[model samples]
Target: MMPAEQAGAAALLRHLAGAEPIETHVSAVFVGPDTAFKLKKAVALGFLDFSTLAARERFLRRELEINQPAAPALYRDVVPVTRAPDGRLALGGEREVVDWVLRMAPVPPEDFLDAVAARGGLDGSVLDAIADAAFALHAALPPVPGLDAPAELGRVLAGNRQAALAAGLPPARVAALAAAAEATLARLAPLLAARAAAGRVRRCHGDLHLGNLCLLEGRVTPFDALEFDEALATIDTGYDLAFLLMDLDHRVGRAAANRVLNRYVARSGDAGLTAALPVWLSMRALIRAHVLSRAKGPGSGLPYLARAEAMLAPPPPRLVAVGGLQGTGKSRLARGLAPGIGAAPGALVLRSDEIRKRQAGCAPEQRLPAAAYTPEASMAVFRELTDLAAEALHGGHAVIADAAFLRPEERAAIEAARGGAPFTGFWLEAPPEVLRARVAARRGDASDADVAVLAAAAARDPGPITWQRVDAATDPLPAVRNALGLNPDDPC
Candidate 1:
């Protein structure tokens, strides 16, 4: 469209939004009381082009087409902003199609996850919601064949390095990060190709971040998928989720990121993707650094650069297990110490209760039959836990095993799995009355232990134990800090 046409369309949209138009690098968003009108800016940015009227219409149609499955309720339509017969303008008017606008159900400003995080309102439910949304989005879509993801990912990484270099970031750091990325990508090339070959690549929400997610009707759903380029949007499913994990680690805390990761892995059963996650996370943060560098110049990129380095720097892997009676707070201590351990976001927590439920083909909160807890079934759960821990540990990630290891052999299985890694075990203890009270207070936790289970555990002799004990009547952070050798005043 011409300048006059674009200017007129923007003016009409602003009138409807009843406020100043929100501008980004590519588009202007006008939010009304209940609706939002977005018009792409007319500029050729090399990677994307909305410079021509036809290109704008094409992208608008593509946005509507691709975002339907992911967020059909919020993405309303691709309507044209037309000039009226008079000097006025309106949406979808009888006048010629002067320009196009993407109309959507307006998500409230406060409903975005970033906004919620700023308000200190982000919770585990929000993480679960995000995992569910991403899993559902990927589950239904079949992968697109012939996606040269290795090459494309390489180009994107290289572009990030070039952009950072052009913006005058620390050259040594940029080169080191770039070299690390190349090495990771080299090692992961086969897996990437296999994922694409196995049809794990699909049309994805390219921009999966906190800012792009909103609590639509109290559920988190991703909006604004990659619409400008098919190659960029067609990606490995887990790779798409890395952006979200990266955002959580950077914007929220590492623990929040780990919470989301564990939830998504359990829900999606995509634990095999952990091998490549470091690369994806580092690459994502580097790209973010480049964006900040190019947009704000110099100092703005420092924090993001540090975050990228942190993603690549794997802390020494350790195997830490929390075991005790039903209400001894094993799970709480495990979670408390998880994010403080090795690797990007933290440890891979493999809860024995969840493993047992999975083995029984039940949900985490569902109870299995009494027979399902037999010695044979118990060994199977332990084997699964050991295997998962071994895989995570070998991949340079810390492991947190949460379970009631009342039996001496159950404890031995974890020890056997650790191999050469440093091993630490904590037994959380509380009074029997306190344990009963804790059991009574349980809601939707994975542990199905009740008073009877606690009494059974008390009845059993697990032989001589060597692990340390933690008092479990209060928060477990202090004990965890002492175990990890962090000062009491050290900020997490």
Candidate 2:
């Protein structure tokens, strides 16, 4: 299409939408009452080129193809903006093709994850759903068998360094980031190769931020996947997920980010990915910093640059175990303390209940049969919990083990799982009536412990509780935070 035809198409899109388009560097989206149209700009960047009508149409079609499966209700057909004999423009006319457009159903602006987060609406349920959506997308994508994971990440690091320098960011900091990232990548190359061989490298949603997510049909759906560049999208799933984690850490809080991370790892059973998390998170932060520096100014991105540096040098990993009877609020205390534990997204909370549910091939909220909770099965769950805790600790990430720890042997095993990391244990206690009432009022939780189960647990003497005892009749977060030396007001 000629410049005049492109101009005509743009005008027609604006007119049809009855508003100005939401413009980006590579595309413009005009959202109407019921319909939305996205048009690719006729520009060519090094990574992606949509300089011709054919290229634009191909990319638009590809976008539809890539996004349709995950968000079927949001992505519609690709249509062409056409001009008639009278030189009037229409969406799909038989006269002459002006430019191609990706048509979509308009989702409410307030429903987007970014908007929801801005209003402090990212509660536990919403955060879990977002992680679930990401997990489903990653699981559905086919592995890119021959892709070189380390080499691909190396390019990302190199490109980010060049871009940061070009954008006039502080030269020293940029250099430091690049150097640290290079060394980290070199260290992780072997692990990356092994993960790739295990089918952990796949085509994923390259740009997975809060803005690209929305609620579709009461379900969190991800849309507008990176479609112009195949190489950029084909990456390790952990790196792909790191984008969302970093975004959440920056935009929301580390607590939200940590919750999503734990949920994803629990669902995917990919705990080894934590080894590369810091660097992946740093890369994500550096990219955002450079983009912001180029768009706004150097000062706007300095914080992100600092964050990029911090993510590379996280605090030493630690293990904290919270143990109690059924209703002592162990899960609640773990959730509250995880954000303050260690690292950017905080500690991984490995709950025995969730692990048990996973072992039984059931959802976290599903109730397991009585047969599934035999002593042998329960011990197996504890063993798996200790294994996972050790894995996360070895990867230089903090962990909080949430379980009854009713057996003295189980306590010994968890304490021994910390290896060289510092370990802390909290044993919670509440009145029997409080425990019974809390268990009775529960709904949609991973724990299957009921009043009868609580009674049975009380019947057994848990031997000696060596860990610090805390009252659980009220909130225990403040006491736990105090014990861990975490500021109550800040979640770093």
Candidate 3:
């Protein structure tokens, strides 16, 4: 239902757009033939007050300012709805101002990522692009000044608890989840402080879910960043990313979530983010739960509440390494296994190809020169892989090291990187001709391996293969899952 105070502005927008508006609690977006106009509701929610003309105009302009950089094509100038001398509400005129509207380019309903996911269209390419888009946004955002990570997180948790209770969710469950989250914050305080000091705290898109992303200029672009509160928008990058991750896990699947996560970490090289992921993921889920409870009653949010609790108590961390010669489906198997391994969205995949690309300061799909693959360079990649794996493992998240662990030392180092966590090694095997064909068919992959590279690797004798070998000529995922004691149909 439209608010009484916004009727005139809403009527003006309706007449201009010749369409009904898509409404949220705080704003309504009216899409016309060529452009869209966003109007703030004149309601004073405790967290934000858009009750007055000045306040609504201020936030409309702020929305324009915050969203233009990320989605320049979507956000346009802010215009006023004016009351002319003739007592007509017009879009823009040099007259008495009544309300403000942010003009933007219209996005098709189908272009939004949430709509895409609804049709099961979030394939690997889209997921990778989404991660890249998120990484780009985070990289562009400047670090926040004087952010107290622990205190900010604690305040958010407290607010979530209060909102949950007020929304009539089971008090016992809400209290328990809040207690768990507070303890997690207490445990991670030092690390969060260090991360803030290291500039990991940035003014990010506070609400980074699928609904806010759209296809723009043939690229997956993020839009509608939180503009009402600077404190909410300023947060640790991992927490900022958690909203998207949590949304993916709920709406799409864990595999999609895991892929985006690994891709984001691969691009940003922020593996330490995994340390705080559980609480971050839980907090995101809790936010959704309470919001849903308030909107649709408590029962609508039980699933999200359950998800929040589950995220806090994920299975213990473990290490899984998938190693084989070129084109043996090592990465494929690793990806297949990761979502079922540990935690809500599963294990962190550290691929040597992506790592090498990171070291060379290039995109994963870009081909690197042969000079970049020297033995020293290769060793450095392995070292970084182990280091990242160790960090994620210590943080109680599973790690999947996806590389051609052809050398004895490389295999041993990965095993030791587990750091007291259980380790499983799977060495994929396939015929030489099959590997050659597969390598030849590859396109746009992170791996730069070719038939010649495979031949060279085949020439070197990688000593004693004791790891479980899976025939890669057919589907190897079933065997890998069986060995890992995971049901083939498990959804993590």
Candidate 4:
């Protein structure tokens, strides 16, 4: 197309979308009041070859097809930008197509998760919405057939390293990043293969960072699936989710990021991902770092490099135990505390309630028989918690043990898991009436402890508690900070 024709097409797109055209490194996005038009740039990179018009159209179709399920209502169709005998540009014209554009319903610009973070709108409820949407899609998407996730992830890491080197990053920094990635890959190879064979690899929304997510109809919806590469899109579900988790940690505060991960795990029952996150999350950050380097150069990618390092090799692990009577908000404090404790996505929360349910072969909300909570069963639960905590600590992840450790002996077992790491033990307390009311009002909790259980717990001798006692009526975050010697204002 000639310069005048290109200019005409630009004007047409702006007119059609009722807004100015916004250009990305790979595409032009024109956002209108109600609709958006995406125009692919006539440029080719090694990973993507879209310099030709035909190539652009093919990718346009791919984008439309793949992204439709991600945000069905948002991705309307692909509209062609064509020229007429009058040498004027028109949208969806019958003449030979000059260019192609992906048309989508426009989500609120300010409601993009990134923008929400900027405006301080990423609250717990917002994060819950985001987690719900992401997990729903994960469960909804079909599994990839015969995928070898370890090999695929290895290739992605190599590509990221190459891109970093090509972007003129300092050789030492690139090499260090590559080395960390290689080490993590080696540790995760067998686990990655197992997850893939178990059908945890799926066709997912590949570009799931906050920018591509927006609040539509009051729910967080992910858009812009990876149309450039199917291999990149079909990935381990946990790894696929790592991008959003890393993005949240990088752009928003660590607390929001942690909240999202914990909530998603609880809702999705994908606790298996907790251990692999150190590797997957680091890979996600490094991939972002290289992608940013390709667009804005190495200088602009340093922050992401630092984030990658933190994810790859976080500060040494620590053990935090949140225990108290049934209604003392121990679980609540544990979940909130997990995000800011160690590295990205925070900690491995080994909840006694969750473990017990697993032992009994029941769902979190299912009622267990009297035998399920027998002394033997309780001992087994505590033992599993200790083992899980030790495993997480050994794997270089922080641990949060959430349980009603009314007995000092039970608490001691958890404390034993703190090998080289610092340990913080907290016992939440409240009035008997408060505990009764809280347990009575509980809904959708993994714990089956009710008013009767709380009454029984209150009557039992706690046996010389060594953990710090904190008020359950007030915010536990202050107590957590105090225990960790962090400043009151520290968002971590």
Per-candidate TM-score against the hidden true structure: 0.91, 0.96, 0.98, 0.84
Which lDDT values do the candidates have, in the order given? 0.82, 0.91, 0.93, 0.80
lDDT of 4 by residue, 65-137 (tens): 8778767888898878878888777888699788888888887678788898988889877887888788888
Report the C-alpha displacement of residue 196, candidate 2, in angstroms.
1.3
Candidate 1 residue-wise lDDT, 1-492, digit = tens: 324547888888888999788788888889999899989988887789988889999999998888877787799998887776676778886677878999999888899889999998888777777877887788878879997778878988888888889888899999999998898888779878887898888888888899888888777878888889887778888789899988998888888888887777666556666767788898888878878888888789889888888777676788998988898888777777777777778787889888887677666677777898888988898888888888777766778888888888888989888877899888888888999999989988888777898898898888888888888878776866787785554324
Q: Model 2: residues >4 Å from true position, as ranges?
A: 1-5, 488-492
lDDT of 1: 0.82
Q: TM-score: which candidate is best?
A: 3
Q: Which window of ten consecutive residues has the lowest lDDT sum in model 3? A: 483-492
Error of 2 at 478 (Å): 2.0
lDDT of 1 at 234: 81
Order candidates by TM-score, high to low.
3, 2, 1, 4
Q: Write the per-residue lDDT of candidate 3 for residues 284-335, one digit (tens) a residue.
A: 9999998999999999999999999998998899999999999999988888
Q: After aligning candidate 1 to the native by TM-score, how far in Å is the CA of 334 from where it should be?
A: 0.9
Candidate 4 RMSD to the real structure: 4.1
Worst 10 residues of 4 by lDDT: 1-10
Question: Model 2 clash pairs?
Answer: none
TM-score of 1: 0.91
Error of 3 at 254 (Å): 0.9
Model 2 is weakest, by summed lDDT over 10 consecutive residues, at 1-10
